[model samples]
Target: MSDSREVVRGLLRPQFREATPYGAPQLDVAVALNTNENPFELPLEVAEAVAGALREQVPHLNRYPDREFTGLRKALAAYLQAQTGLSLPIESLWAANGSNEVLQHIMMAFGGPGRSALGFVPSYSMHELISVATGTQWIAGRRDEHFDLTAADARAQVQEHDPDIVFLCTPNNPSGTALGVDVIEAVLAASRGIVVVDEAYVEFVRPGTPSALALLGGQPRLIVSRTMSKAFAFAGARLGYLAADPAVIDGLRIVRLPYHLSSLTQAAARAALEHSDALLANVEELKSQRDRIVEGIASLGLTPVPSDANFVLFGGLSDAPATWQALLEHGVLVRDVGIPGHLRVTAGTEAETTAFLNALAAVQR
Candidate 1:
């Protein structure tokens, strides 16, 4: 009789409540490189455009937003074409609240109960959570120290699980190493189902390195998801899109809720697209800063992985949990990667980078 409902819930995924590293901060600090966020504030022009769009619209919170978000989709498609140099039809584009929701749509559309999803270990954590939430099994293949996607290893796992969907997070979340385009093509060629390339950090990479988006035509089963969150300085806006064949987009539409995006969100995203050139310029700056951080970590006798994204993963101290706590005590919050002694730190503003670097030095000493 006492809380029988709560008692009925026998347990939860151990990882769900496993005291993971997130949101640990107290006093206001001048620098915060824990979360991978664009250090630059939104450009004045971009902010004004977003505000102007909202002002032009009649207050219509009473009415739902455009269910399909067609206009915004077209804007995004055009922006992507400019970025990736691929002609993308609006029908080939799908938008969601963020890459997270975009990812969920992919899982819902292709993976379900009894299906399986493939991912690489030490990659994004969301892939596992999304798979579990959708009642699909998540299978991970371990990567070597370099974080390269070994074709042989991937092929063996693909053959074993025959997953309904595969996720490739380029410039991978923790390691920040991007899988080569050729490696990605090989995966799609070998994959028996959909292959999703999450290019959430593409902006930070060098231009010559190809994006998975460039391989869309060569591989019909490929789906490339990008987010405005990191590079655009719009983590708060939460706008993300997936580029795929029209059929793939249509499949996701079947599973998405009506009016998945609010008009304000759509307006903001569209406006943000107008200033992508400026936003990407900041990305170049971040890349330089990231290089500095990586080199600094290595010079300190730590092993820093080669990174092409907004963050870097490094190993120095033997105990990650203790080191993470130590860094926090010094007012530096960082991502505590579950790897034995690894940590991920975002490339923040110059000031933030200095704080992280100084804190790391003090902690290691």
Candidate 2:
């Protein structure tokens, strides 16, 4: 018989290694915006609270954490209530090691071999990658030339593929376009399958952008996923949650590992939630920075996509990686999306934005 390792290797799914490259760039720069992370730190009070929680639970490290994460879940539910103006009770909420895992769980529970997952072209690539990993077909519908999805296009795709799941990233990544809620509702009405609205960057958008959570209770098949990674400055903490119907939450729970979140992770996230005010203050600042960065990019005669998120995507940089590398050479790092003639820059602090502009001009020279 063949060796166990050899057998396992042969059995591994072909899609396992077919992932798109995604990770933050590490460069020695005063302002780094390669990833869509908040360019701020957790508030002092929240950090202290997290430390306190960890110290209080230090003696219990030997014991397994509460498998259900009841406390952190409740805090998250409350925070969502205040943030989204949606009455998301703890029963309607579920957490994973991160929102990334939450989406994976969704794919596992609702998508597989015969089923398919649908998303818009040039949206977050992770959605496509996750669908492939689940042995599901990943179908992408191209957006209009303006980088906008039409109501008719959405309905047509939903009717055609009739996917088991549809993933939409609000303030859609790499493009910086925010799909309207009315358009989203139209898609949901046409879709017979589950619809996941990823609101990872919603906080950075202007108020009243109409989050998918607003339509949550009314639509049983709708799930709104959020992460504390961007506006909340908790990327390293790796926390994200979902607000959905009880049935959907139950489905997610089926695929999750017991104690998927460590006690420390739960504590850190809870502390961050407790200081949402401070975190959101930082969000407001990022919005300001986004405006300034967009203006600066426009001043350079580049076309900057109108972004309601923490990052701005611009066209005119035909060779994105080379442009990105040039910026890096000048001690500034930005994201170089694979799309032709496109580049994205996160809005850092005021000084960082200026530095990036200077570096950009220098590269052009």
> In terms of lDDT, which candidate is strongest?
2
Give per-residue CA lDDT, model 2, range 184-244, as digits (tens): 8888989989999988888888766778887886798999898988888888889988889
The sequence of per-residue lDDT tens digits that candidate 1 reaches over residues 233-277 is 999899989899998988998999888898889888888887788
TM-score of model number 2: 0.94
**What's the true lDDT of residue 343 in model 2?**
85
What are the C-alpha RMSDs, in order, of all predicted structures? 2.6, 2.6
lDDT on C-alpha atoms for all candidate structures: 0.83, 0.85
lDDT of prediction 2: 0.85
Task: Provide the global lDDT of candidate 1 against the true structure.
Answer: 0.83
